[model samples]
Target: MQRSVEGQPGSPVNYSCTHSKLNLLLNVNIYSSASPHISLLNLSKNREFRVFFFSVSKVTSSNNRHRPGRYSFLIQFYAVTTASSPMSASKCTRLSGALVKQLLDSVDSILFDCDGVIWRGDQAIPGAPQVINLLKEKGKKVFFVTNNSTKSRKMYADKMTTLGFDVKEDEVFGTAYCCAVYLKTVCKLEGKVYLIGSDAMRQELEAVEIQQTGVGPDHICGKQIDWANVPLDPEVKAVVVGFDEHFSYMKMNRAMQYLSQRDCLFVGTNRDTRLPLEGGKAVPGTGCLLRAIETAAQREAQTVGKPNHFMFDCVASQFGVKADRCLMVGDRLDTDILLGSNCGLKTLLTLTGVSTVADAEAHQKSGCAERQGMVPDYYVESIADLIPALQG
Candidate 1:
């Protein structure tokens, strides 16, 4: 059977779908921009399918009349035979072509991870800038959410601009900035912070008028007893951990001392164990440093990064973003996809970074409910895969 779904008046696109016993093929025609195209969607035999229509409009000036708002369709196929069906769980479907358009059209805001998503180290991923710029051009709200605490929001924005991405300081949310916000707004912390992080973290804390000590390196000196008796700052009321290249035994001992205080608060940026870089390389992440401090202090830290809900809360509270209409795109499943699950937002995993299809499949097959959250709703070979859809 065939069914037709029309777009808004004056829109140059039209969608027609042909349904068969085991497959559904959607034919889309963009008369003004391109020729007709067909997108094939597989429907498992004997399964039920539901189609949802979501309208996504582009903001245009009054003088612009060539392009009009468009409507995209999302098709969700399910196997109703049993509740234990694999399709009933996480769909880790490959996102491409029309699926990309449908997913993008369903959301107003898109949150992206910095490293491994857009760029790694100092290099921008191929075609990443174009994808980001085009998404903004299409009137989508784009924000960068990274667990790396090595850079402040302004620093992140500056770096993005250099990498050819059109970004603003307000749109970047690194753990450094969020950590400062958490202390000031949530904890209502008074006095100083015993920081075990980078100078960027110190800058962010100071920006919020939160005094912080313990930036740079702290060398080990004297005997083991002397280290145990290390002087503690009387005004330090909190211990904040982030990525520190100079992490040493002395610094860990100092953080434990501050955390030992009965009323001292403990916070960490994120628990990401590895920061993936270009060419399949990686380095120890901030989580390693945070774990060391936590072990020594014998206390768990209140993390303010992904999968913690506070990070999403920070974004939602600022821009009035609705969780239902947001998409979180990242390379890691444990942090990015889990954050989306926690926030009730759609998630897409890209292969350009950490985590693989095997990892996601393992989570999906595992009967554990907690592991299921790590599986993404959809995945793409790379964020660049969205470029074709955006261009269309």
Candidate 2:
């Protein structure tokens, strides 16, 4: 029998197995957070087959108290060898088929989640820099997307550089930029927008020559509309949505009032139901606010996030790439994964964010099997694990 413990290299777990008469190999691969399961080629069964088990556990305080916190997944390949049937050659060959197929589907581009997958707030996860560098060295394109509307593209680029990752401003996409582009091309509002979100969002609106107003304006640019002391007017032409940290009941009421008016356009950056916070907590994202407005006004808002074809089209046009070739790697099933399905691109889901294996399993069992614009071809744990699969 052979045993192996595979995880990020140099992590707290030194990765050595102990057994009486067995050989083990520790193969470290960094897959994009897109894939849900860490696939292993089970070659231990050739000798003799007995029992196998899998479990996941967090690192103890004694280990390195940083990123990639030492998750040791043990695959115990047990073979109770007997004299009569010493080798089960057929079963070993059967196992090879499964691993090969899973590995063959790995593709070109790798998209990553900015928060938990790479960094927490301004802190980079352990091995994040190496993971980024490795992919770039191999000529694989790495794109990081975040729902964080608080920072500008420059802010993200600078922060990544500081964290030891080679990043370009254009490589990172934010909800604010997507919303701004959509508003410029679709709405074509030249007058004013009641601004919301952070300075980054404001800058994006300004770039499109859209004017800002306090009250009695043409449109409302709402960020955390629930928290800002926004002035409402009868002439408000549209209500735009994005991430808001200070969401409240009063804000919902104000948005409902504005949306109640006929001929008013409702727009949102993206409809991510929840955002990932440090320490593994869930917070409402733009989708939460969009739902409230839609429910109150009984109308749908123009969504401008991933999984929406417009965002994908804009990315292809701006980067000069084809949808069929690019891969959409994201954490959320409703947004990132959906973008691939909807745009005729490949979809990958990671467990580092909003959804889990159980959640994905339920989604699969519900008979929502790989439809045109809403299914993922693979599910991975994080971007760090995706590179190895891609290289092979």
Candidate 3:
């Protein structure tokens, strides 16, 4: 079961903190264990996959047996983290102006994630553009790394410019472009690809001159069972999945058929399960489509986006930026925060997007490595809050 807590508009939230401090509404799912081993999961809006186990029987709770309000299991959240992590599992540091200045001095490159961090939907977050521009003025290298695969680099750059940021196409690093690069450099595919994605994905792949099919709508057949009769393309050696509004059973079946050959490679732009929409509404993301295809093919796809390490590689490898000297600022914890932790980069979470401080508090208690990865080294109320520090 899950419940939501609504807090302040732009304040750090903790799971156990007073409700007044939490402005943004967050959905949190608490797990209860029945077995000897307590299995805790971070069931949040991001669908983070941090799981851990500890002995529930050994827990010293006053109430031992299961009851209506009296719980039988002793619950403790175990988070995922490495021994070398300098971050404290007890708390997420609130960045003071002095700390922010120190962080700026230490990092040479700063990477920003779009959507929640810079802006929510079409409206740009106030002061975001100024902070980004200020970083550039200070001789700091800035880049935009996004898990959103629906748009190409040019499209992202255009959107950023429209939002009043000084952005260029070369500085935009989105999953769609990274997937194309992965296919060309890592996969080294010369044959055709069976693509299940948007036109932007097609644009990126086409820019790299990678041949593909299955871009538009899949026509529904008169016969429900058309798999045996449908012809297969032997040249389709790779099956790439991204955000595709036209994804259907036919597309999934065709992708599976090609993937069933064993030689065909399976790839995905990212693993984000849901896209956070306006008015608290959310639609299925590329992960859903990829899962459908994977279910049909009975094979796991190699994801090229956030928390996968490949996304950061796109920037680090191309720009020669040192991970240790870089800072990653974003809104989402599961993707942005985890990506920063995965790449050994300092992470700052802005609550302008999906995750709130309460989410970090929950993970801190868990001690789960995966959940710990989602916990940022520091957090700010919003990206706009950085403006004052930048001025200093």
Candidate 4:
């Protein structure tokens, strides 16, 4: 058993202050006959590990018969100490701003998102074309990934080309494409699916020879559902939910009823809780549907999205790219950033879409920081600014 005592101020004479902040320092002691020694792991052989002395307190041992002249133990303190100073605030701010330009100078691959960051609501954003051109000029590998199941990669490629950017279907990644791959490998799903998504999702389903039809008990019924049509199809063997418009209570009620039935499988594209709107107000994303379904059925749904290894496996196998060598770029933290980081690939985030640095700061302040969790290694304001930032 292990015990932790916190909120102690100052260091005892036999104790060491491992950190400048007293609140963070910890002292551990075991009431034993011998003092335990501490060894450093993964430390450089050239540099010495520091240790200092503080005061110690001896108390009576609770165990009566086993003790001999009162056992001695050590109240040892340990922390990851650093004599190296952090960069100046001014310098950090400047470097943080310049990080993207520096990255462009180093990294050879780039991935982009189609909506919001590239084209917002059918219109190309400013600097979108220039960024693509710049990447091409540098001969950097580029790909596009999106959670929008409303359009196929081919359609997205065509749209990007029409909007004056050079793009290809082979370089596109979408939730619909990922779902098709997941259906192919994981669950081996087939037959008619009761789709509540856009024409794009239906097209993909047909391409895979999966039947798309009206809701019925005979088919492997599922919904590529969005906000407006979360309605559960009672006959569906699988409940496939995606991003839908016009989401409401009726749709959720239907989804609940179907999911509550025994032997039904539930699937969702991604678990993004909120999405960006035109004026910056965030609307609940697919995660809202996921929770409702989970609550109704009292279980978790099988998700197919970024940072989900199924998508990574499909993409890596299809391209013959090693997961470590591949780089993933996206605007959303839960999906894009998490996907790359989870799959052992380099991850990058941009401020041009869903998440912002302010949001990241808020998360850190909330006391949820992890040593190796879902944070992007790099961040940029936009793809267009990447080159300059890298050069600087």
Candidate 5:
């Protein structure tokens, strides 16, 4: 059976299926007023299924209105089948074999999360380089989007090259770069930033002609009152937070003092709490420091990294990437997959990072609409799993 629905120009349209006995082989075709038509086919033998399709449109918002007529769309797809079948809540399907190529053929651009999707720490996952190189060779536009704010775009590209991946600086978008772009282009701040991040963030801010303070250790040297009365930079107009190995109490106090000003803007890289490493080891991520700053400042920060549309905007604006023709592959369900979900793109979660198939299943069964966004449309054991499909 086939159904057609016309969505509002800038709003989302939702449809649900509740028929228990009616088996559906879903084929979704999206037509945009400003773009060409795109079709997606889902062949499923299970008794229940869910499908997500992204449509392109021009959405006008306070932050994005300057770029008029640009392609953008936001849609969230969630379904809880009423059928008694065991696969009813199993939307996170394992991707393998012929299914891999079929999924790859459905998108023109693929956004990969670096830390867990391609490499772990300093080592690239087995067959990861082949999969990435082959995807580019197949005429696919590949981009790396990572929330690790400790590295700039050039730094990330350099690391990728050393790890045997085909990458370029412009194709890499890390929070350190995106946060700087956000401050310069979006915020249009005229002064310096009170930054609680790494040296790489300082480099990115400098690249955009934005000055920043608070990169190194800021150890507390005096009493509480002295810390409260600490000197502040009058030119500082924003408080930017990211991954900081040298995060200290004095730094948090300084950020709080700067943010206490009503006009001072607050921004953060991302909210990922843990950074997963090889052999299942993990460490604190930027979220820990950002949260501390938020607590002290009593203010919420405008984050520019994953799960935020701004991250996708950084890539889409540069490459003219359309939501309908893009796929987001990442390891974490909260940041990576949620970014894809937030931006109206297909989401694929690999088990090589923080989230697992069981975690996705819990969200699927949670019956919470918001948590549903964290559930990816598909899950894979590893990105290396795609090598065979690319080879074939």
Candidate 6:
């Protein structure tokens, strides 16, 4: 008698064995977040049952979107992927079997989501590197699109290389770099920026020779009255928001004060609400920081991230690719899938990230155009599942 638990790496599932260990066999497979089913195949004589796990984390608030580093990813999954789920025969086709060839033949280029589709946090998803490389070898143009503003294009390329993915700096299109490009070309602002983001964003902007202030910590000096008297950069003509580790009341106040001027432009990297991290934990994303400034300034920011068509334009215009000829692959329904739909590209949803099959099902049946953007054209249990198809 033996027992076994099988799951993908970074997949967390809790199992308890109460029965006597008389060589009982238990197999547990923690699949990507996209999978909505949990199959427990019992070879033992008397114990064969499937247990449903659906206890994932919750956002602290819809408006704030901040976790204060207090939420754990250990929250049970929102839904267990099942046969009727979005990617599972009910809503879309699985990119497997004969469909694999069909999928690959349909698109000349592919856009990928960074966090859940290819890698979770600093760790790489299984078989993701091989698939990306194989796609390129087969004449597919590949690009990395992420809403995360914490890292620059060079940094993102470095991380991909560190994790064994064959990627180049230009192939990576992050919101930080896009925001800088938009400011330089579209907005054509020549003055300085009062930034409420990390040095990474600052670097991206500075690379294009955009000057920035309020990047690092601005210590709270004296009292509340002192904040009112804090020196301001009169040259600042724009306010950009991204992931700011040093986001403080002082910084927020500074940004708000700058935006108080009618000529100041408000911008953000992306409005992604939650950032998925290691250990089943998550933190407030740039959206939260951006929203905070928006609330204070009472002005809507111009976001250059996903679902906005700007990120796609960055790749399409530069690489001479067409939206109809491209495929966007990602884990999140709202950002990745919606971005694909918004840009007129095919969308593929992988379960290894923040969204779930149930989420997609709701959108499919919602009868709302907004909700419908989330429905993926295809889905696979994991990006790894595509390896065999690419090989064939």
Candidate 3 lDDT (Cα, 0 to 1): 0.73
Which order, best to worst by TM-score?
5, 3, 1, 6, 4, 2
Measured with C-alpha atoms, the lDDT of residue 201 in candidate 6 is 89
lDDT of 2 by residue, 1-392 (tens): 33434454221122334354433322322211121122121112122322222323223222231333333343444434433231112111111224423433333555665776677677886666777887677676777766677777788889999999999988887778877777676555444554435567777777777654322223335566533545676456667777766555555666767655544556777777777776767677778877886787676665666655566655666766554446666666666665655544545665666656565556655653232223356665665564554345
What is the TM-score of each predicted model, taking all chains together? Answer: 0.76, 0.62, 0.77, 0.63, 0.78, 0.76
Clashing pairs in 1: none
For model 5, how does the per-residue alpha-carbon lDDT over 298-354 read when each residue is reduced to its tens digit?
A: 776767888877788889999999875789999988888878766667789998878
Evaluate all candidate structures by whole-model CA lDDT and list the values in order: 0.76, 0.56, 0.73, 0.55, 0.76, 0.72
Task: State how far residue 342 of model 2 sits from its true place (Å).
Answer: 1.4
Show the colliding residue pairs in model 5.
none
Going through the candidates in the order shown, the clash numbers are 0, 29, 17, 18, 0, 25
Task: Output the worst ten-in-a-row residue range by lDDT, candidate 1.
Answer: 29-38
The TM-score that candidate 6 achieves is: 0.76
Worst 10 residues of 2 by lDDT: 86-95
Sequence-dependent TM-score of model 4: 0.63
lDDT by residue for model 1 over 1-392, one digit each (tens)? 23334443222232333444333333332221121122222212222332222222223222222444343333333212222333224388998657788888889999999888999789998999999999999999999998989989999999999999999899999999999998898767788999999999999999999999999989999998998899998999888999999899999999988866645777889998887666767789889888888889887676789876678878988998887689999999889888887665778999888889999999889876557678888998889999989999
- Tell me the spans in candidate 2 whose CA falls farther than 4 Å from its real position: 1-109, 214-236, 246-254, 369-375, 387-392
